[model samples]
Target chain A: MRYFFKTIHLIDYKNIVPKTVIGLFIILILLIPVFTRNVVTLSTLIMTGIWAVAAMGFTLVLRTGQFSLGQSAFMALGGYASAILTAQMGLPFWPSFLVSGLVSGLIALLVGMVVLRVGGIYFSIITLALGEIVRIIALQWEPLTRGSRGIIASAPPPIILGGHELVNFNASLAPYFYFMICLVAVTGLVFWRIGESRLGRTFAGTALNPVLAEHQGIYLMKYRVIAFTVAGVFTGYAGALYTHFLQVITPMVFGLWQSIQIMIMSIVGGIGSLVGGPIVGSILLYNLGEYLSRLDTPGLQSFLFGSVVVIVVMFLPQGAGLVNLWERFWNKVVWREEEYEPDEPED
Target chain B: MPPAEILIEGLTQSCIYMTMAFGMVLVFSILGILNWTHGQLFMLGAFIVFYSTTAAGIPFPIGILLAGLVMAGIGILIKKFIIDRIKGELYIGVATLALIFALEGAASLLFTSDDRGLAIILPGVLNLGVVAISYQKMAVIIFTLIVMTAMYFVLNHTKVGLAIRAVAQQPVAASLYGISTERLSLIVMGIGCALAAMAGAIMAPLYPINPFIGRTPMIMALLAIVIGGLGSLTGAIVGGLILGFLHSVIAYYISYLSEVVLFGLIILILLVRPQGLFGASAK
Candidate 1:
């Protein structure tokens, strides 16, 4: 009888509340198309979702304690691959998307084999160089990439169900927005699961101290490579989707500026919280840029963005994620006196 | 182009890259943070020279001096306000990146995004057996030599230079020996900024000045630093010359693909010798 009770307690639905909240939030997002028909707003939301996916990828690499400045290179590779496949080879969008992601992951695997040998700042510098190399190649390889003129796809592939075309992505913003939201949601779930897994703990351990991790019998390089490859996969997916959405791709689209923006999103969202941090950061910063641009000051957005990054790093080094703030707020509401008592011991 | 002409062009480019790399190495040694804004400061210096010479009616030499002084002041202020407060490699990187964006934005707004150029102070070309070298290029080479010689003297013989070196070698020990690491860092930042500004001011007459112009030289300086070894000054110089020569020769042969080759070589070097050609293995 006692054993049965213990088992029952273990199976309690304590996690249901947050899950339901997330479900309802997702439902609300799904209902956005019904409520508003603003193309600009839909496009903005779509971009936010796209950036959120990339930022999440960046956060995964950061979890391994490696700063990668070559996200643009992977993104460009994926974009080019998808673009070339659909436009040049006449491949279907779905297959091209998958292949492009795999292509990026394959490149990451190869690059990671060599670059991961040097950790920390050296790794960052090599990645920067790598990004530049990729950009230059894209610029110079005129026959394949069409140089600065860029590639323009005719349309996003239509989803066919039971030999009938179900949805055309190129026709309207609503369907694309829905697709983006779905992608973002799925990516978030995957990242959250990874973060909660034993593998995630191992990545944390490796990041904290490579020597210590090695002492604990962790293959540091293996974990770093895995994390890097996973990041490349997600970033590549985002890039592929972005190509189809825009229907035109350029080497200049995924340059250092885009890379920096992704990094800023990850950092600003608070690097600690994998799911909420990046999504919130992407929305906030992207919208902030839009808002600043509307104010008619040409460089004010960039200036403010830079200032925000410096301030956030200095004051909230963990990031500006809402999870911690929410937890603190909940604690204050439920047990303020108990929380305050712990401070007395330090004093 | 003749081989002799390519060599001269390479040497001239190397001198500019060397000065920039020297400043980068100095700051990297002391602060242990790569200043992403270093290139922007170089741009700022050129603009200052442009304004002083064109708008304020100052002479070329005096304009260069003014740029150096102004940049030093800016560097000192940046150290005290932004860098001093930031700790750890990651935070410093982010902060410096932020500084780059802010400076770039300011430059775009203040100077307009258009490209500006300075009149060549020296216009005549010197004729040689197989090559005709411009006097402007000669001036750049001579100026670089003079600046480097003066830097060597200061670094080797001066008290402040000793203090700077001691702090870089062992911050705790130097502090124990009555050197203030804080003050030393501020001074080093100023000196580094001044050198970058001087390089910009000198190179301004040769190339068009723009808000985004610092990026290429900055990348070259970084590549030079990496090739020569991260913290070693001599390595930076050697790396700069090698890169400069490669750039000139490769661009001559392959036109636009020089950048691809240059970066590829850096990656190759890094894979084979992660410690750099002349640098000690990093701890």
Candidate 2:
């Protein structure tokens, strides 16, 4: 019975990826219209999309052996900058977006200069400090940010789909959800390409063995800076999406807790796992929390999250552990020697 | 504010900051990790004091002491069971993060996220010239000093402290001399956590107590330890003073920009001395 299943999987592996993706995405996209009539469902989908995009950006840096606990900080940087630009300055929506990305990129560029020097827990600590610094500035600069009172009614992006223009994407959650879906697809494609690029190889090598990579002329500093900047761009995209989703901006939006939560999402999705953002860690757990709160207080929610992390660290250590474990079992069932490792460049 | 009052507040605040920083330095000296949950341990201490005094009907002094002992136990368990198995900073980070969530969850479930003030150890005020100091706060300051001084003596003079220090300086070498470096780690965690707990118990009446209250002092302690160097016990105290004074002085004048100003100083300090002001190392 195992042999039959193995033979089928071995023959159908190439065809499986697209089918599975399409199957899940269709279920989700179909629910969009069905659930569009309900505001809460739409909001949830939109948020999940935005968070996934940001996590992908985070995943990019991890590929080159970098970690960012400051994702929410950049998100806030983009969110606030663009909100201020378009709403307060009356700038064009697209220009404000590009500006947001640029601001985040520039900030990342500057901070990354020193931050890149550190790695592991030190990296998380620096980013945590940086995030708090950003939060404090946002809170205290009441003239610009309006302090903890929070700014409301920051307008959303203008969407152009198939030449059909919608002025306010935030008017309804459906359009924003669709917009974020495109972002996820685009961000995933970009990250996959970068992960396969020579630059990514240098980063991967640096992460794998920094001393060796430096000896081989990988130029660790250059790649580190690039990875940080790229992360900034994608993170900014997520931020812009988040601002629209929440329909308000505040220093409270990007606290150290939020940053840690996002980091948890990326890590739970498994390090370097693209699109693991929504599926594995924070998003799934966060969604579960939201749903569970309808029944009881949110106290038990974090407990569940902690338990998940403990389990992952103890038993899995690799990822969700299901897929990786299944793949291993399938390999043994098929007796495929080539499945031992993928030495070729990532596709 | 009068000169004397300002001096009193500054000194007291600096003492609080130094106690927290001292605990942080101990962890780094022994475990070689920043122990992000150090702040949460401090938070638990506060909560435990509040619980023992208010809910369990214990006297203030007894409540505070019990809180310290209980939290120290939790700290040892964390070091032995959770942190012991993890390898690499990243994995340790993930594990501690799990602990953070768990602790926060427990805090939320048991005591609510809302901040609750604790009863003072000794209430009323003591007026001396321009300065009018709260007796409760003065007691906190005194307690803080005693603990800090006691810790300093133990670390510098005692046998167990010497063994712990020896392990921190060189784990491999210490183990060869039959130090049971692992056991020493548990003891260090206990001492570190006990100090943090005492700090929380003493300050419970001053600040509005909450599950996440640990966040601020931990950050301040981080600055103290980092500025002092990651593993420098003495640096932690010095850094704590620098940061504490930075807070009192800036918050006195700048108010809103105080946090930013403080971080700016830390960044400048770090740029100049990455190993910290004291230049301590884990190895």
Interface RMSD of each: 9.2, 8.0
**Model 2 segments beyond 4 Å from truth?**
A1-38, A63-66, A117-123, A153-171, A274-279, A318-347, B124-132, B281-283
Predicted structure with the largest TM-score when compared to the true one: 1
Q: Kindly provide the TM-score of model 2 when superposed on the true structure, using C-alpha atoms.
A: 0.88
What DockQ class does candidate 2 belong to?
acceptable
Question: In model 2, what lDDT does residue A247 have?
Answer: 68
- TM-scores for the candidates: 0.93, 0.88
lDDT of 1 by residue, A26-77 (tens): 7898999889989999989998899999999988888888888888788888
As a whole number from 0 to 100, the lDDT of residue A207 in candidate 1 is 76
**Docking quality tier of candidate 1?**
acceptable
Estimate, for each residue in B86-111, the C-alpha lDDT of model 1 and write its tens digit: 65566667778877778887888787
Collision count for each candidate, in order: 1, 1
> Model 2 scores what on Cα lDDT?
0.73
Residue clash pairs of candidate 2: A265-A282
Candidate 1 structure lDDT: 0.81
